[model samples]
Target: MNFEIPPGLTDLLQEFTVAVLRTRPSNLEAFAADYFNNLNEKKNGPLKLSGALRFQENDTVNIIEPSDGHGSSNEDDDDDSFVGPPSSYRDRRKSVSAERYDPEADDEGDYTKVVNPKSDEQRRRLNDAIKHILLFRSLDHEQMQEVLDAMFEKIVDPGEEIIAQGDDGDNFYLIDDGKYDIYVNIDGKRKLVGNYNNEGFFGELALMYNMPRAATIIAASRGTIWGLDRQTFRRIVLKTAFNKRKKYEKLIEGVPMLSSLDMYERMNVCDALSSQTFRDGQQIIAQGDKADCMYFVEEGNARVAMVNKADPTATVEKEISRVGPGGYFGELALVTNKPRAASVYSVGVTKLAVLDVHAFERLMGPCMDIMKRNIGHYESQLLHIFGDKANISDLR
Candidate 1:
């Protein structure tokens, strides 16, 4: 039968083969089968296989084809016959009886008993696959191996909720097998948001920000996953050559509007700015909606619009301006604490720093006191910006 191996699986097989050869066994075929079987029993049957070849029991003495198939023979077949100590042999027998069984027949409902034995190469492939997923696409070979030692793997059945929206997320996951669907509840209905495949990652935003899960992820099929909890992931990211938060703080301090603030107050402003991400075309702030926070553009672009009051019967949307990186918007929300005068929608993948009312209150308290002391200075500035039409009655 024709079978094709995926690039990922082939790499895994190579690793497994190396591991098995380091602890060489007498019968290569038997060792391979035993190793495969053990992995199957441990991982259940979610593991996939390809390029498998088996030998008939009676034809063991005949020359078996090597993986390269160049007519080489096993010269040590006779001399390398396995002879285990009595105690070891008995332990093996007992383990086989206790742990090796058909998952379908087991009353205990354990799912991992169905793994068939695999060749040395296949075992290596499985191990490589696990390592590859733990490291994901960003880490290099050496880093990947280190991560493999620290990571843990698990198999989950379909319909399992890996993370729930609104819950504190402490772990991030990389898919090794099967698929998953992501959803967010909108207007009382679960709306499909995204899908994940092998090597795909989710729950990263929560890990970075320590916020609640923004969406719920459900296993779409029997899946194998490699996950690292928040503590470990944090250590890895923070240990990198560049710290993202520190870099962002330095950039924010350079902005003219924030230059008046000292280093401590600037840090407080940064702390107040919550990390928010949105997909293209997603509405960030609705027109005429009660605004509670100011937003600073960190990445991507957004269109600002206000209702065109020209036609009273029909609602009109007029785009006023486009805001992008280093540009700030929604300052009115921070000051007036009133409804948003305009709506903003993402033009592409967008990241924003949102400063809410509570954060603004805390950070602006001392600054406000300073402004009150120089009331005439502030009043002149406001008058120059907004003429006689500007209302200063609300300030008192």
Candidate 2:
């Protein structure tokens, strides 16, 4: 007897099977009803069906892919899907958490937090593993501690499959010990792509973007790995981003020069800014150099000093002023479009929110008027210090 499965039915069954294997709900009938309803909603929505997953507000399950001999062969067909860095052992190199993130819905109250205890040695190893991961790098001291608490260790045996190709992504894995082989399906044949030994991470792209696993990871020897559940990862990532934006927005709003910018304009400025840090005594800006960016002090302080260029042999710098938190500098060069008149250095361990000249011109149009209005005040200070040697071409 020949039993034929319709192509549409095959896709439906494939999705259902993956969902069930991952979720493993106690009641199959009830799970099926909810699964199909959610699946239908996702399908009918504006987004087309592909390698994308939606992280619901209330979902907590560590469902992995079942190797039922129906693995998709088209998983690795895309160009550049196999490119990797030295420790990269997977398919694709997309930016971490590139999907549109809505932090408001990712509140801690929405789901039960997972807290798996680890010994001091284990905690240190896990910290070292995830410290460099971009998805976890944005997390602060408290958030990082939360993440470490949520992670549980998984012991892998030789030849055991940790992640199967085409599986629904549920957890992000970081290697704590041992090695693993990576394989991808190419032309219906599994091809060895790469390996992760002692250090590396996989399954992040799938969790970050809600996409299917692009490669299979199998342990080559007994090893222990740390895993963070999907829900916690998303909540922490989104919430941290939201908080950082709000913090920077508050700082940008405090700048008197940019007070004229409306609410929406202020938000745009927040998006354009990038955080920077400098150790004590580090030179942030050099005098007479072309200024392409401005800085907003977020924490600590920066000293702005005027350098005497009249006597080239006797190079000297005089501290003119200090910029504290919520203060800004380097805008004069961007406004006057000339050489930097003063050099700025970090007074202590300083932090800054940097906005480049291009972003300044585009988003600071309204603020530019205010800056030009204060041009006389800036010029007067320069004239007071340099006397006849004051050159407007060198800027204020």
Q: How many backbone collisions does model 1 have?
A: 8
Query: Model 2 clash pairs?
Result: 22-63, 53-210, 81-92
Following a full C-alpha superposition, what root-mean-square deviation does model 2 have from the true structure?
A: 13.6
lDDT of 1 at 142: 59
Candidate 1 versus the native: TM-score? 0.35
List, residue by residue over 166-241, the lDDT tens digit for candidate 2.
6567787888888787666544556554566677666665654466676678899999988888778767754664
Error of 2 at 225 (Å): 1.7
Best model number under lDDT: 2
In terms of lDDT, the poorest run of 10 residues in model 2 is 1-10
Query: What stretches of model 2 exceed 4 Å from their correct place?
Result: 1-102, 246-294, 298-303, 306-317, 321-351, 354-384, 387-396
The candidate that wins on TM-score is 2
Candidate 1 lDDT, 1-396, residue by residue in tens: 222212233223433333332334578678666665655543356544432121334422211111111111212112211122223223322211111212123243332222234455544544566443322333345544444544556789999878766556567666677877765444444545446665455665554434456556789899888666554454443222113334458658645566666544564465345568899999999866776877778889988865543335436665657888886676554465556656899989998877777556655654454434444543454455445643343333
Task: Score every model by TM-score.
Answer: 0.35, 0.52
